[model samples]
Each structure stands twice: as C-alpha cells, then as structure tokens.
Target: MKLGLVIDLDTCVGCHACAVACKQWNTSGTTGPLTDYDPYGENPAGVWFNRIRSYEVDDYPNNKTVNTPMSCMHCDDAACVTVCPTGASYKREEDGIVLVDQSKCMGCNLCAWACPYGARELDEDSGVMKKCTLCVDRIYDEALPVEERQPACVMTCPTSARFFGDFDDPNSEVSTLVRERSGYAMMPEVGYNPVNKYLPPRQRPKAPTIEKKEAATGQTLIGKWMKRQKDAFNDFGKGAR
Candidate 1:
C-alpha cells in the first residue's frame, strides 16, 4: 500500500513538535525505552526517530527559512534493508514501512552507514539499530479510535503540516495533496525512490503598494497628529525658556 507521510513545508513553522511527539510515543512503543545519554549534560544525545532541520533559502532581503522534518523515507529500493547482513532491517511488503528487528540486530552498523538520509541510529544501550516504524503498532490497533490511528508525529503536528496515508492509493489524501501541491521526493537522484514526499513552500502574495497619488496628505489623521505633537513640543520649549 506504500503507506507514508506527505509533509507541507509551507505550513511547517520549525516548531519541532513532530520530533517531540515521535520520541514521546515511540519510547514506550514496540521499540520501547529509546536510549538517552547525558540528557541534562553538556553533550546531550538520544536516539530520535524524527528530526527537524531548518535552512535559510535565498539571500538577505529575499531570504526564507525552510523547516524540514525528516525520518525514515521507506524507499522502494531501501539500501538499509539490503545492507543488513542478519536481515534485521526489512521493509514490509504490505505497507512499504521500513522497520528494524532489534532482536535480530548484531550491532553491525552497516545499515546506519548505508542510509543516505541519516535516518537510522545505533542504540548503544541495546547494541542495535533503531529507526522510524511509521508507528505500525498504533496504526493497526483495533482498540484506538479509527481517526486516531495515525503516527504520533502526524497526530501531534500543531500546524497540520503532516499527513499520513497510503501513497499507492490514487484517491488517498496523501496522493491528492502530492498531485495538487507538486510534492517531491528528497534526493531523488540517489535513486532510493523514497515514498515520503515534501510539498514545497508556496510563493507568498505580495502586499499591494500605495501609488504616489494615493499617498496621504498632511490633512490625514496621522499627519495632523504629528503636527499637533510638534506644535506642543515647540510651545513646551518656549515656556521652558
């Protein structure tokens, strides 16, 4: 079904809400208790599934900030899966979600090195590799409400920038948004054919400029107020003298 995410870059505000949510939910999920080393210390580090990166586009006056939240792309030609010697990393045939079996992992670090997107991380505590699982445990659970069966990141995004659905379905929201917004895959030249898509920032509408003829004269409210302030200051200065 090619289940994946379609992120809207235009609406994302670099809040890191998705990253926080992913960490919170997945810590106690199927891949529970993600490792954290020196969280309160100077060199705080942890195994995080989602990461938010912001880049400044263009230069100076015309510059814009682009916030990109990245995780496992679940590529069609997933190199992470191919590189795993013990078959620890594998992609699901039914949904195209990439997952790491911690039990089978041998702390080889091959999959982490092979991943071009830096989506995989080694859990030193468990001596195994960890990555985004698309919240498979939550999505397929019958106990949860139907509408609440999305990934933690998708559910917690405050701006509604994240969407999750089957990319293979033409009628799905992900597919429709991809078609309408001209969404694109990251680093397509790498040939991984990532399922996750990102919608580019839309061009902002320019503010209408006031022509010279439409400029406010001295009789305008603001001009008159300024004139009154000047006169008051001059009178105060004369009285002080």
Candidate 2:
C-alpha cells in the first residue's frame, strides 16, 4: 500500500503543534532521545522529524500567509535510499515508508545531501541519520486503538489539517482529498514521486463593496465629524506639500 499524508495547507495555522507532537512521541519511541544541542543557548538546535514554515504569498494588501509542515515524503523513487552507500536507508515494500537503519549508518551525510526535501538530519549524539518513520512503531501496534494508530503529527494537529491513509486506494480519504482539492506533491520536477500531497488554499469570496450615497443636505453628527477629520487630513497633506 502507498501510505502517506495529505496536508491541507489552507487549514494549517502555523502553530507548530505537529512538530512538537512528532518530537515528543518519537523522542521516546523506536528512535528514542533525539539529540538536542545548546537548546537554551543563543544557537539552539536539535533534530526534528517535522518542521513548520510560514511564507507570505503575493504583495502586502492582497497577500496570504501559507503555513507548511514538512517531513519525509516517502517517495516512490526515493533519492535518499538510492544515494546511501551502505544499505542503511531503505523503503518498505509493503507500506512505502522510508527509514534509516541507525546501525548501518556511517555518518556519511551522503543521503542528507541527496535528499531534496531536507527531511534527514544527523544525530551528532548517535553519529547517524534519522528521519520521519511515519510512526511505524505506533501504527502497526495492535495494542493501540485503530483510531489512535496514526502518526503523532497527524494525531495532534489541532486544526485537523493533517490526514494519513493509503494513497493507492481510489476510495481512500487521502486519495479522494487529492482528487477533489487538486492536491499536489512538492517538487514533482525533482522526479522523486513523493507520496505526500499538499492541498492548496481555497479561493476566498470577495467582500461586496458598499455603494456611496450622496451626502444629505443635513449631515448627522458622526458624518459631520468624519467630514471634518477628512478635511483636516487633506489640509495636513497640503501643508506638508
């Protein structure tokens, strides 16, 4: 099954909740105790499986802010796996999840450089690479409730902006969302065929403009006050000129 995520960019609020949840769950999970260096220092840094970045689209007045949460894409043609000299980086044939074998990793940094999405990070503490495992340990556990079997990020998203499902199934929620919302994969030109899809923000309806009426012969107090303020502003501009 081609399992992956469908992230609704329109709904993401840049809260970084998903990132925090991923870090919290994975820290003690299959890849426990992710490294953190100088966390409280001026240059705080750490390894994280997910990251949220916000960008403003268009110019000031008409601009929109887009919040993007990124992680391993689990691509069909995963360059990271192909570039790993040691057979440490591999994709699961059953679920399409890309995982790095910490034992086989030699801290070569080759896979990191080869990955276009910057999803892999070197754990200086372990001297190996790590990435998003799609919470494999949690998802496959029969002990956990089926509803709670999704990735930590997907489970903790406050806005419900994230979705996890099998993308190969035509009727799957992920696939249906992609078809209906015109969801797209990032950097498709890179030819990795990333399984993760992003749903673009929906178009907003424009507000109806109020038609201006002719000023009445007798003005109300508020209108007169507004007129006075407008005249003062015009006078100030004239004086400045």
Candidate 3:
C-alpha cells in the first residue's frame, strides 16, 4: 500500500502547527528525544521532521501568500534509501513510509545530501538521521481511536489542509483529492516520483463590485459634506469680493 499525504496549498495558513505538532509527538517517539543545540541561545537550531515556508506570489495589491509545509516525500525512488552507506534508511514496502534504523545508522550525512527535499535531519543526541515516518506507530496502534490514527501533522492542521491515506487505493481520500483537485508531485522532473502530493491553491472568487450610479441623483453623506464645503468656499469668495 502506497500510503502518503495530500497537502492543500490553498487552505494551509502556514501557522507551523503541523511542524510543532510533529516535533512534539516525535520527540518521545520510537526514534526520538530529538536533539536541540543552543535552544535558548542566540543560535537556536534543532532537528525537525517538518518545515513551513511562506512566499509572496506577486507585488503590492495583487500579491498572494503561499505557505508550504514540507517533509519526507517518501518517493518511490527514494534517493536517501539508495545512498544509505549502512543500509539504515529504507522505505517500507507495505506503506511506503521512509524511515531510518537508528541502530544501523552511522550518523553519516550522505542520506541528507542525497535527498532533494531536505527531509532528513541529523539527531546530534542520537548521532543518527531522523525523518517523518508518517506516524507509523500511531497509525498502526489499535488502542487509538480509528479517526485519530493519522499523522500528527494531519491531526493538528487547523485548516484541514493535510490529508493522509493509502495512495495505492484509487478510492482512498488522498487519491480522490489528487484526482479531483489536480494534485501534483514536487520536482517530478528529478525522477524521485515522490509519493506525497500537493494540491495547488484554488482559484479565488472575484470580489463583489459596487454598481456605478446611473443618474447620480442620490447624494451620499461624503458627497453632501463636499458640496457644503464648496458652498462655504463660494460664500467666502463672494464676501471677499
């Protein structure tokens, strides 16, 4: 089953909630206690499974903001898995989730370099690579509610922009969204064939416009005020003469 995410670019508000939620859950997850260096210092940096970026579409009045949250694409031709020197990073055949076996990992930065999406991060505390596992542990756990058994990012997205499902199943939600919304893979030209898809922003509805005055008989408050000012100026001119 090719399981993955369908992210809607139109609805994503770029709140970074998905990133924070992913960090929170994964910190204590199977491969974590994800490290932070100088967290409180001037140069704070840490390992994160997700990152959000905002970009402006145009200039000034016509500008539109696009918020993109990126993580492991879990590509069908995963470069990270192929470049793993110790065979630590691998993609699961069952669900297509890319993961690193921390035990086998040698803290080599090769996988990170191979990935074009910059999905992988080196956990300094564990001295191994870390990335999104699609919350594999949570998804398979029978204890959690069926509805809640999604990735932390999907669950916490306020805009409901992130959707997780089996991409192999044509009837699945992700597949349906992809087909209906014209979802697309990032950097398909690179040939990684990323499993995750991104739905482009929907066309915005045009703003309602006020109708032009037909005869200009009705005077507005502002127009009346302007007329009064004009009348006063005329009277002042007459008195001056």
Candidate 4:
C-alpha cells in the first residue's frame, strides 16, 4: 500500500500551476504554516512543498525543454529519518510517506543537512524539519469521498500529468504507465530508492526536411550567415524577455 506519485514530463507545460495549487491548498487547511517573507520587499522567500524547474536539454540541432516538478521523494532508506535523533522523522510503512513529528522535534537542523536532494527544510515556527507529506492530511481523511481524496497538487494539475497510486501494485495505473512508457528514478546514483518515478521524455521521430541537409552541407554561405545572425538575435531576445 505504499502510496506515491507518477509525474509525466511529456505533457507538462512548464507552467507553475501545480506549484501554485500546492501553496494555495496547503496554506488554509491541514498543512503547516507555509509562510512568505518579504513578499513585497526586496527579497521574497517562502516554504514550498512542490517546485517546478524548467531544464533546457539542447541536443544541438534537436533541442528540447523539460519541465520537472520536484518534491519530497519519500525514499525507502530516507536519510532524514536516519539523521533524526529524536525519532521525529519517520517513514510510514503502510503508505511510504516520510513525516516529521513536530511535537518531538528539537529543531536541530541535522535532518536537513543529511538530505542530498535538498528535500528537508527547517520550519521556523514548528522548530522541525518540514517537507512535502504528499498531502497526507487529505489522503487519509475518511470524511471526503474516496476518489476525491488525493493531493491538492495532483487534483489541480490541468494536464493531469500527476498521478497518485500504490506503487507496490504491479497492475496499478502508475506502475503500468511506468512500464509502458519507460519511467526513471531521479538521481539513481544517490540510492535513496524514491517511491515516485519520472516517465522519460518520449522520443519523437525526426521529420524529413531540406534544412537537415543545409546544416550538414553548410551550403549558401550568405544565407547561412544571415540565419546565424537571426538566431543570435532570437536567442538574445529570448534571454532578455
């Protein structure tokens, strides 16, 4: 019954909708004090359960942008749990979620240092290490309808790119999707054994075009020079804009 996420990189639009939805739901409900500091001032810092980062994987002539949604990995051998001296941080065997018992925490900040993925953070108010609980409060509440019980971020994702399910079940949607689409774990070298898996970027077929030949042959010297200048200007504008 180990619960987890299955995020699809293929359909993600690089929009921050998922992150914003997490913040919005976690603030006024069962989630902790997701505070924002100096919001209007010079620097703005806040606790975020989910973060979306856009990565440019420019494979030269065939470039692509991948938008990754990152959060607590809820690992099988979670380092934060091992580092907690007071048994505050523990992984739930039933659902495979890692949580910190705020009442027992001493705000030692040791747990945060142990996490290589930057998953842990010190909660100033609770004096404890805080991270994504995968919206545990909503998931377990019997008051809500069974199907409706899911993480706020997953529920609000416009593209339906986020999936919630039991990874242990071989036939589950998440697991089936993983197998069919070639899913991969993030930072496998770290050996955290994360429950969630990222579906690999689908390989698109190269269309037969005259441009490929033009690039390979380096023909039309003047045209090539013009295209280069135009490319440079476009790149500069993209950076600036």
The CA lDDT of each predicted structure is: 0.90, 0.90, 0.89, 0.82
Q: Which candidate would rank higher by TM-score, 2 or 3?
A: 2
**TM-score for each predicted model, relative to the true structure:** 0.85, 0.85, 0.84, 0.85
What is the Cα-based TM-score of model 3? 0.84
Candidate 2 lDDT trough over 10 residues, lowest sum: 209-218
Candidate 4: list runs displaced more than 4 Å. Answer: 207-241
Off by over 4 Å in 3: 206-241
Q: Write the per-residue lDDT of candidate 4 for residues 26-110, one digit (tens) a residue.
A: 7665557777766688887877888889877754356677999988888888888998899989999788999888788899989
Q: How many residue pairs clash in each candidate?
A: 0, 0, 0, 0
Evaluated at residue 139, the lDDT of candidate 2 is 93
lDDT of 1 by residue, 88-113 (tens): 89999988999998899999999989
Question: Residue 227 deviation, candidate 1, in Å?
Answer: 32
When sorted by lDDT, best at the front, the candidate numbers are 2, 1, 3, 4
Evaluated against the true structure, the overall lDDT of model 1 is: 0.90
Per-residue CA lDDT of model 2 for 1-241, tens digit only, reads: 9999999999999999999999999999887677798788998798999988987776433567899999999999999999999999999999999999888999999999988898999999889999999999999999999999999999999999999999989999999999999999999999999999999999997546443333322277776766677557445434343
Give the total clashing residue pairs for model 4: 0
Candidate 3 per-residue C-alpha lDDT over 61-150 given as tens digits, one digit per residue, 9 for 90 to 100: 345789999999999999899989899999987788999999899998999999999899998877989999899889998999999999
